[model samples]
Target: MSVRGFVPGVLATAAATACAYAVAALVPALNPTSVAVLLGALVTNVGLNRPFLRLGTQLAARHFLRVAVVLLGLQLSVPQLLHLGGLGLAVVVVTVGLTFTGTRLLGRWFGVPPARSLLIATGFSICGASAVAAMEPVADGDEQDTSTAIALVTLCGSLAIVALPLLRQPLGLDAASFGSWVGASVHDIGQTVATADRVPGALTAAVVVKLTRVILLAPMVAGVALVRRHRSPDTARARIRPPVPLFVAGFLLAVAIASLNAVSPATLSVAKDVQGTLLVAALFALGTGIHLPTLLRTGGRSLALALTSWVLIAGVAYAGVRLAGL
Candidate 1:
């Protein structure tokens, strides 16, 4: 597409992203990405999205999302995962792997399509909306499937911010243990921090554990790409697409740079801000593709899968944490 074709949609998305940030600031519990999706959906459902905006919005949702995913690597560090200790690391792995595989199985049983199932599993098991965005291309999912998965994960993550804290005492977990639980179970980084922040001294462990899960994103995405390539009927198309997407490689490179401790704290902070802004804009674009009526008609099984996946992850993480004695 021409640069001129992208201008309108990009501008529209940018304006919506800024509005989302403002709204999130006003409502601390609501994540900016979630608000962005809602804003995009509202615009589309209300007929505010014009033809001129279509190309640009599509660009934001696809290319811009990849850029944001690459930048997300700056937030991770190998040392941080190491700090989680062997048992804590094991907890993260078990939680993510089982939740991902279990969700896919549940989706199949529920008669959900493979693409939607993969997207939902990625969102729930990895890092919520961002993970969904990263996996969409590899999963070969349509916009509706992508939006549905995002909505499901975002809704569940928001609920975790409220529900997990209330369960801490009942689960007999102290602040740190609760933090570990929140990290292992919560879908998004912001939601994990929000949940753990309810208890003093929980934020640190929560952030570390969450990053460890984030670190798995690259491998998981690569694995999916390889599997998709292997199963394709068209060998020519399979050969044309790399087994690992370029953006995934960029993400790994960013992680390596961060791990080397070469980037200044100020630089990393600025990159984080940039990443968040891009993600907000990208999600808004994707949200524009959502038609609420259609989603409502087709989403029942997906919703059941999401809820079951949520419970499964939380239960598995809890068991792993207890067994590991984290």
Candidate 2:
């Protein structure tokens, strides 16, 4: 695409993201990504998306999203990672593994296609829409599949923000336990943080546990790449894709730099702000690509899969919390 074509769409996405952030500031319960996505979808469905804008929007969704993810690593450090300890780490691993594996099995049982199923599994288990986008290329999924997965994950994450807090008293969970549960179960980092913020003393544990899951995003993507290559060596030979994408490697590098404590806290804070803004823009781009009618037509099976995955993660995380005595 020419510079003229690209800049307009990117600018439009940035404007939409700004609007999303403005809304989020007033309505704290509404995530910036969610708001961005909704606005993008609303604009496109209303026929406002033009040719030049479309190219930039696609670029935002594809490239900016990865950059945002890479910046996510600056949010963590080694001591914090170790702070989770053996028990916490074990719980995170088990929860992610089961959610990823179980979602796929359930998808197959429901007769969903493999590529869509894999994207859904990755989105639900790893990190919602970001994970779906990261895995889409590897899974060979279409735009429809990616959009559907993002929608399902976003819906479930939204529900968790409300439902989990309501269950806190009935579930007999202390702030730490509740935070851990939210971190484990919620699909997105923002939603997890929002849920945990409802309780006193929950924020620390929640961030730690959630970051643990975020760190796993790299390895999970690599693992999928390995599995795909193993399954079809001929195809692998014909077209070789790296097990770890460059952004993921950058994520790891950022984590390492942050762990070293060489970067100042102020710098890290700026990075976080930038990351969040990029994510908002990327999500807006992804949202613009979604066709609501098309999603509705094929949403039934995907909805079922999302609900089942939500239950699985919630149940498993609850059990992990109990077993850990958190």
Candidate 3:
């Protein structure tokens, strides 16, 4: 039986999601990514407070997030990623590579226990909030590590929302390029939107590229799960096999649906909206999975490594985008 009972996060996710939609309708100027992340975590936390509730809410939450991720993809096309062409592909490679490099080196440097570094690294570098959600079950990350990663991504993305506008002004870049850079760099979809809003005329490109990165996250998480297994000594004796992360599969299937020519734009848009709502809820559930004291047990080294990974991603985003002329 799950001991932790969810209350606050669920309350937070529902209220926040409502707030996101209301502002979108009334003020017509709000972006919902980070808020969704927060609310998702909150709502799911409450769902998990009881076994029956957790089971139902958890499944529903995942289904929603997956659809959201796919719907978000409808904003892009194969050609755009191809347009950035080889250089565009490089952006993803570098972002992912740097993230992994930082995680491994820092993890070792800080003595960050074992699995924590890998999980946080994937979350921060590849897809942000979604990546962490996908990686948790596969990597078997303890509840606390997952929570810490969520908190870190959310905090960083929030800071970007405020800082990105000023950044665009100083950079002296045009819309498409800026969008590409932001898409290539930011941690989550909301940050991409928030960053786009601040930059002027950057939404379409940024959101699309960000979706490109999001689609790539599943493979990275799956790989991490395998590596973790290879390194585990007990695999030989205990015959443990890693569990396939269901959300990752769902995320892929959603992508397939989005890629189909048969799906109408209106239908895709609806799917995205609904999924965005649910993904946020799933995150709420993942947040519910978090236990405060358990997170604190991370070997002191892990925190330092995680911090370094985040710092590197943020810094690289700015410089890499500029260098790429995005």
Candidate 4:
């Protein structure tokens, strides 16, 4: 918390994020947030850690990511919300709930620890690393588990960037259906945009559906916090905080303002840019905390959960699209 401790972590995060942006510029297909995470991991694994940067990196990963997620709400508006309507919203709710439940059960079957598995389930089923970061305190999970869940989400999301496009043609999906599938299934907004942008008519549907899933993030986090509190012993009950997180409140406010169309287009664009930048920096901070050896110890089980979840979501999304007649 001291200046000396904080400055180093900020500098490390900033540097890693800078490198991630550069990489993204060169390889536009790669998600900048995921690239930042990988770069952060690379820096740490390669022994580039400075002692002073530790606390700052932790702050960046925890606090900064929440801020970014709030900014993310600016990208949504009433029009996009209406596009999905009742059916689209229902599909998002169903898919997210099923994926979350399935992943947790699968994680148990794989013998992964409860907290870590919960984090993984939230991360994979919801908004990827941001969701994982948000759920960390609520779940009272280990940093190692947070990093591992993020890494697995990143890995699977990255794979989808490549694999989804290939399957697009083979699966004979039209533009709208393909977009809906990607929006429903992909972990992060950046990854969703990148995947659906490949096909015409897909981008709009993808963004709409993806943001619908994002809208559910608040309740999901609140539900987790509530569960954790109820499950805690009566002696410790007094220590439990409110179920709704502050940043999630900010997220809802942003969405409400955005829906009102109060913000100018130029201002919204700037917020979007800021959101992306903050997320990259946060992911880099998170990456620096990772230990490859520790991650690998549970990697197989985590990977299995991720792969199974990926398949499940993809299939579910496809079914949703077909059922909706999109």
Q: Which candidate leads the pack in lDDT?
A: 1
Q: Considering summed lDDT, which 10 consecutive residues are worst modelled in model 2?
A: 236-245
In candidate 4, what are the lDDT values of residues 1-326, reduced to their tens digit? Answer: 35776887888788788889899889988888889888889888988877667888988988889999899878766577678888887788889999999989998998888888998889888889878877887776788888888888888898898999899888888998899889999999899998898887899888889988887888898887877677774746426566677888788899889999899999998999989899989888888878888778767788788889889888888888788876
Q: Residue by residue across 60-150, what tens digits does model 2's lDDT show?
A: 9889989988898899777876899989989999999999999999999988878999999998887887788778777888877877788
Q: What is candidate 4's TM-score against the reference?
A: 0.95
Pairing residues by index, what is the TM-score of model 3? 0.77
Off by over 4 Å in 1: none
Q: What's the lDDT for candidate 1?
A: 0.91
Query: Model 1 misses residue 310 by how many Å?
Result: 0.8
Evaluate residue 209 in candidate 2 and report its C-alpha lDDT on the 0 to 100 scale.
Answer: 90
- Poorest stretch of ten by lDDT in candidate 3: 1-10
Clashing pairs in 1: none
lDDT of each: 0.91, 0.86, 0.64, 0.85
Q: Which 10-residue span in candidate 4 carries the lowest summed lDDT? A: 233-242
Cα deviation of 321 in candidate 1 (Å)? 1.3
Off by over 4 Å in 4: 233-238
TM-score: the better of candidates 2 and 4: 2
RMSD of 2: 1.4
